[model samples]
Target: MTVLVTGGAGYIGSHMVHALVDSGERVVVLDNLSTGFAWALPAAATLVEGDTGDEVLVSRLIAEHAVEAIVHFAASIVVPDSVADPLGYYRNNTVNSRNVIACAVKGGVKRFVFSSTAAVYGNPDAVPVAEDAPLSPMSPYGSSKLMTEIMLRDAGLAHGLGHVILRYFNVAGADPQARTGQSTRNATHLIKVAVETALGLREKMAVFGTDYPTPDGTCVRDYIHVADLIAAHMDALRHLRGGGASATLNCGYGHGFSVLEVIETVKRVAGVDFPVELAPRRPGDPAAIVASSEKARALLGWQPRFDDLDTIVAHALAWQRKISAEGR
Candidate 1:
């Protein structure tokens, strides 16, 4: 049996592919290359350039690979982009996800691991938001993901598809060994922008909304290492394969750092200072939303090794340096 990973050429998705292949799991990747690179994938894993929204292609891959599980990560994830084009986000994130789930059910793929987001909480009423928190999405990206979660729930109940929905907080860092990282061009991630600025790849980075009511007047986020995030996905796969019931779990460190703190860490880690300009808040951004990841800890047995902020920044800096050296 093989694992079918959607968007496996993207940053986080690529990390998941590396981890899965390292564990000797047969892996098949489906990506459109819109924001993904084929070089990011390992030779051990096969890449099929395509879109996840194509049910016919997805179905064929499932049958050809004898796929037993799916680790989905394909979607448009930029919050501001989603806010500007809600319909596009809905079509790519929600409608495409529906197609994937339907293919999974029809293909007899029993296990599913969904990539979700904390944005679903949408300025959560309280800190350390748990899995049961209200689902008030502030952006179309979040709403699209929330809609998929609902679809997965219904599909799991009606089709007996064991699934795990991991609502990620802020996924940062590289593969820890510099094998893959956030290589997306014009990325909007806070840490990625800060690191690029420190590396002089960007003239300066903008700090979006310095009046978010955080301690430092910037948005606070729970930044988790990309490696750790991939491990959580592996755990989800194990849980579902072991006959565990369907579950929705939060993936974070249960704490957060303000945007200022993250930028400072990147500067210190890179031993450089770059200009930062404060700007108005981008639409669809939440002020602060941390994660109560105790469920993942207890349920998935998740143990995060690189929970330190400096460590995450160092790995990201290293990857940035690698890509710069290679002119990637």
Candidate 2:
């Protein structure tokens, strides 16, 4: 049985693919190459270039590869971009996911691992937001993921499809071996931008929203390393294959760093002080949202290897230097 990983060429998806292939699992990747590069994947994992909304193509891949599981990571995932284009976000994130889930059911796929986001718990009334936090998403990106979660839940209940929904916090860093990392050129992730600025890839970086109700007056996020995030996905796959029940779990380090702190860390890691400007709040951004990942740890037996912010920054800096040198 093979694993069908959607968007397996993207940053986090590529990491998952490397892990899967390292464990000797047969893997097939489906990506549109819109934001994913074909070079990011290992030769062992076959890449089928296409959109997830193409039901005919997806169905064919599922049947052809004899896929028993799907690790979905295809979606548009920028908060402010979602706010600017809600319909686009819905069509890509929600509607395309619906097509994918339907394909999974029709093709007899047994397990599914959804790549979700912590944005679903928009502006939680408390810190360390748990799995049971309120489902009031403030952005279209979050809402689209929530909609997919609903569809997956209903599909599982009605069709016996085992699934796991992992709501991720801010995913950062790269593979420790420099195999793959966040290579998107126009990425809006905070750490990526700060690293770029420190490396002189960008003139300077701005701090979005400094008046938030946090200790340093900046938004706080729980930044989990990409490798750790993939570990959670692997655990979820094992649980599902073992006939465990479907579950929604948060994937994070259970702690957060403010935006300013993250920038400082990037500076310290890169040994450079880039210019920093303060900017107004971006739309659809929450003040602070951390994770309570006890449910995931208890249920999936997940153990995060890289939980320190400075370590995460160092790995990211190394990857940036590599990519910068290679002109990628």
Candidate 3:
């Protein structure tokens, strides 16, 4: 049963490809290279350069590869850019997702793992947001993801699709084996931005806001390691394959870290103190957002080993340095 991994050439998706291929699972990757690179894809898995929105192409591939499950990761993910162009967000994130799910159902793909976001909670009042928190989204990107979650749920009712929606917090870090990492040209993720600054790829990066209600007066987030997040996906896939019912799980360490603290960690790990700029809070920026992963632990049996901020920083810095050495 080959797993169809959309956007399998991008940062986190590429790592998923590597994991799937290495674990003896046949994998077919369909990536458009919009924000992904062909070189990042592993040599073992089958790679098809295409779009998830192309129904004909996707359906053909599903038949050709005997695709049993899908790990959907293809979508635009910039928060601020989604604000500037709401329609673009809807077209790519919402509409394209509909096409992918349609193709999945038509092709008889039963297991699905949708990559969701913590943004669905929208400035949650609670320190660690639970699974049943509010569904208010503050950005078009968040709204787009939430809409897909709704689609998946409704799709499950009629069709016999076993689905898992993993709402992710701030995903950072790289492959522990250093095979593939976040290679976005201008990534807005906090850890990636700070890492690029440390590598001199950028002069400096700014803390989005500083006057929040938190003790540190900056946005705080539960920064989960990228590898751990991927582990949750694997567990979800296994559960669905084992005839488990549908579930929506939060993927995070259940601990919050300040932006300033993350910056200091990067400086400490890199041993270079780059200039930090204090800037006004960006719109749609939440004061603090953390996840309560108790459900994931009890349901999926997930335990995050690299939960430390420094470990996450170290892996990200290593990948950034690798990219810098290549002069990309």
Candidate 4:
């Protein structure tokens, strides 16, 4: 049976595709080229250029490929952009997802893995945020994703849809093989922006808000390598396929790196000291955010391989060099 990956052409989704393909699983990818490119896909999987919300296309693929599972990754991810366009965020992240799930149910897909975000637990008072933390999303993007999580829970109860909701914390790094990375046109993730600045891809990058009561007076985020994070998803898929209960687990290293520390790592690894401006904090940015991934570890028996900050930065830097060389 094939595994269907929505938004499989994008950064995180593409890595998941790689992981699935290497495991000798038949794979089908559905992604609109809005922010995704066909070039990011591995040769082993078949790519279908279409919207996840397209019921006919999604349903047909599930049946045609005998798809047994799905990993939903397509969404509008920018916090500030989601703020400026809440309706657009809700429509794509929520409304479109509804369509995908509806198709999954109709097709009787056995397993589902969702690409949720840490933003759902906005401004939590706890560090190493647990799965049961109070969810107070501070942005439309987060709220929309939270809505989908709720829908999945309700649908599971009503339609017996088994699922694994993975709440990701600041995914970074690239395919260790240097195949793909954060290819977004203008990504604002702290690490990506910092790495690009080190490569002279941009003149400078700002450390958003240095008065957030953090150790270095900057925002702190738990950054997980994309490769390791996808490994967690693979484990989640196995759990679900093996009749494990639906789980909402965090995908993070359970620790964090402040914005300053990350920039320092990039500078140290790239062997270049770039310019950084200390700017006011951006809205919807939590002062410090980590995760309690103990459940993922105990349940999935997953161990991380790329947990070091330097290794993450080095992989990202390599991808940046490729991007610059290819002029992509």
lDDT per residue for candidate 4 within 1-328, as digits (tens), equals 9999999999999999989999999999999989987899999999999998788999999999999999999999999899999999999999999999999999998689999999999999989999999999999999999999999988888888899999999999999998889999789887889989998889989888988888999989999999999999999999998999998999899899999999999999999999999888687888999999999999988799999999999999999889889999
Candidate 3: C-alpha lDDT: 0.91
Q: Model 3, 60-106: lDDT tens per residue? A: 99999999999999999998899999899989889999999999999
- Give the alpha carbon lDDT tens digit for every residue of 46-67 in model 1: 9999999998999999999999
Positional deviation of 143 in candidate 3, in angstroms?
0.2
lDDT (0 to 1) per candidate: 0.95, 0.96, 0.91, 0.92
The 10 consecutive residues of candidate 3 with the worst lDDT sum are: 319-328
User: Candidate 3 clashing pairs?
Assistant: none
Best candidate per lDDT, number? 2
Q: How many backbone collisions does model 4 have?
A: 1
Show the colliding residue pairs in model 4.
209-281
Q: Please report how far candidate 2 places residue 288 from its true position, in Å.
A: 0.7
RMSD of each: 0.6, 0.5, 0.8, 0.8
Off by over 4 Å in 3: none
Off by over 4 Å in 4: none
TM-score-superior candidate, 1 or 3: 1
Candidate 1 structure lDDT = 0.95
